[model samples]
Target: MPDLGKYADAVLSSYAVSLVLLVALIALSIARSRRVARELHEVEERVKHG
Candidate 1:
């Protein structure tokens, strides 16, 4: 907050966009990890039974 002066809008908007993208990336990664973990568990169960 140290006097962005004339470029305040541009700078703030960039920060907002960056934060949003970061959150979305994190969410997608967690979802993908969970899905892969579940699929691996299922495969392991099938192999054990077979």
Candidate 2:
């Protein structure tokens, strides 16, 4: 936590933006992975039965 002094607002805003983007990316990836996994499980079941 170096003293940002006069540059505090600019630095803080950039950090905030970065944090939001990273969280959004992680959330989307998790959702996509779940969907893909479900589809794969369904395909496997179909093949096993048919």
Candidate maximizing lDDT = 2
Candidate 1 overall lDDT versus native: 0.98
**1-50 in candidate 1: lDDT tens per residue?**
68999999999999999999999999999999999999999999999998
RMSD of each: 0.6, 1.0
Error of 1 at 3 (Å): 0.8
Clashing pairs in 2: none
Stretch of 10 with least lDDT, candidate 2 = 1-10
| Global lDDT of each candidate | 0.98, 0.99
lDDT of 2 by residue, 1-50 (tens): 99999999999999999999999999999999999999999999999999
TM-score of 2: 0.87
Prediction 1 TM-score vs. true: 0.95
Candidate 1's error at 5, in angstroms? 0.9
Q: For each of the candidates, give the backbone clash count.
A: 0, 0
* TM-score of each model, paired residue for residue: 0.95, 0.87
lDDT of 2: 0.99
Q: Over 4 Å off in model 2, which ranges?
A: none
Candidate 1 wrongly placed segments (more than 4 Å)? none
